[model samples]
Target: MKFNRRTFIKRLFIAAASIETFFLIKGSISKTHLEKDKKELFNAGKADSFEKNKPYPFLTGQFFLRRFDDGGFIAMSIKCTHLGCIVQSNIKTGGFNCPCHASQFNRFGEVLSSPATRPLDYFPITIKNGDILVDTSKPTKRKSFSKSQLTYV
Candidate 1:
């Protein structure tokens, strides 16, 4: 049990390596947990909160929640398919207009003009206990709007 320079240096190096290894593993585990936690579903409030045939803009979430007359909901992304510009909602027309390239989209996100060949992207909507939840993590891109895209309550 004699204290020697070589032994002390070796033990210190081993301890330092062990600590670094532990930290690296811990960081990776925490990152993975955070990714799992970030499912990122935007809660759009109660189902009854949104009026029929009206577009509710969630700026922070970057999506528009459009409620149809038949209790159907469609969450469309605000990012314009043409050059990724943020589309502005035309309340009077109940459609979307892109300021960047003058791309127009109808209420159903269908493309009305050029510069954009596809319709506006949309997120998946889920109804839980009368609440509207839009999955903003990933948007579904489509060439046109269809009845299947609408979520009915």
Candidate 2:
């Protein structure tokens, strides 16, 4: 076969396209596997370690574990409902602030300001052998706080 410029360019394009497609498929497959292998439940820590009226931000997991004055515990997601940006806890304001869109939410996850039409998402909490376990995989979105959402030790 005689080597031509047109043929060489066509072959190069084909090889480049093939390589790109392969990488995209490989990345998607790996992402799927990672999602499947993710842990559903995370151990927050011992029940005693949490202090009343304090919010413990789990930065790695993007959630907050708070203890109320009544000895009640609640686990809430940090992702803002408005734009999915991480909400930061403002202890001075006793609420959460979404730096992305300025959406505000109270410590109870109730929406105190606009932009975020709904409250922050919360994960169910379970105590097993005195260890507080939070189900990070499943999150419940609510507009108001409920008695059932609180877990008492």
Candidate 1 residues lying further than 4 Å off, grouped into runs, are 1-38
- Model 2 misplacement above 4 A: 1-39
Which 10 residues in a row give candidate 2 its minimum summed lDDT? 35-44
> 1-153 in candidate 2: lDDT tens per residue?
999999999999999999999999999999999997675888999999998888899877678999888888999999999989999999897789999979899989899888999989998899888888998987888869987899988
lDDT of 1: 0.92
Question: For each candidate, C-alpha RMSD in Å?
Answer: 3.6, 5.5
Q: Clashes in model 1: which pairs?
A: none
Task: Estimate the TM-score of every prediction.
Answer: 0.76, 0.74
Deviation from native of the Cα of residue 27 in model 2, angstroms: 21
* C-alpha lDDT (0 to 100) for residue 37 of candidate 2: 62
Candidate 2 lDDT at 101 equals: 79
Output the TM-score of candidate 1. Answer: 0.76
CA lDDT, every prediction? 0.92, 0.90
C-alpha-based local distance difference test score of model 2: 0.90
Report the error of model 1 at residue 57, Å. Answer: 0.4
Instruction: Give Cα distance to truth, residue 66, candidate 2, Å.
Output: 0.4
lDDT of 1 by residue, 6-114 (tens): 9999999999999999999999999998886676789999998888988899999999999988888999999999899999999888999999989999999999987
